[model samples]
Target: MEANKFLDAKGLACPMPIVKTRKAMNDLLSGQILEIHATDKGAKNDLTAWAKSGGHELVKHEEENGILKFWIIKG
Candidate 1:
């Protein structure tokens, strides 16, 4: 899991977090991971749904201190 870029949208809200993640994923190469740090309450569900719909994978996610650390592999 090598991440070429990291997007910290920790204080962002709702769709922005997923939007930012999608934009970053579009710019990433296949097999490259995108590390996302966000606090959006919807991230867990949004990211999961996006990953499924886009045919990508969410490798892992951890939430602590009201922040979510997402490790995603671009499809």
Candidate 2:
């Protein structure tokens, strides 16, 4: 899906991906989408929970070639 901003967190681990995602989301307006590319396997669950807790929408997510992609709409 289309996104307003893209955050590449590839090669990072754990909290780093979520941390970067949080920072990147700050640059977007409400309802805008932030696309994140992370190699951390834990990012899927971390981001999903983070988005839900922050009231943002986790639009979709998938994995390919060990890369995890997520689309989050700013709340």
Q: Pick by TM-score: which candidate is best?
A: 2
Q: Give the runs in model 1 whose Cα sits over 4 Å from its true position.
A: none
Clash number for every model?
0, 0
Against the true structure, what is each candidate's TM-score? 0.91, 0.97
Overall lDDT per candidate, in order of appearance: 0.88, 0.93
What local lDDT score does residue 48 receive in model 2, on the 0 to 100 scale?
92
> Cα deviation in Å at residue 26, candidate 1?
1.4
Model 2 bad stretches (over 4 Å): none
lDDT of 1 at 60: 92
**Candidate 1 lDDT tens digits, 1-75:** 457889999889887998888898989988788999998788998998999899888999888898888898888
Across residues 4-74, which tens digit of lDDT does each residue of candidate 2 receive? Answer: 99999999988789888989988999999999999988888889999999999999999999999999999
User: Global CA lDDT of candidate 1, please?
Assistant: 0.88
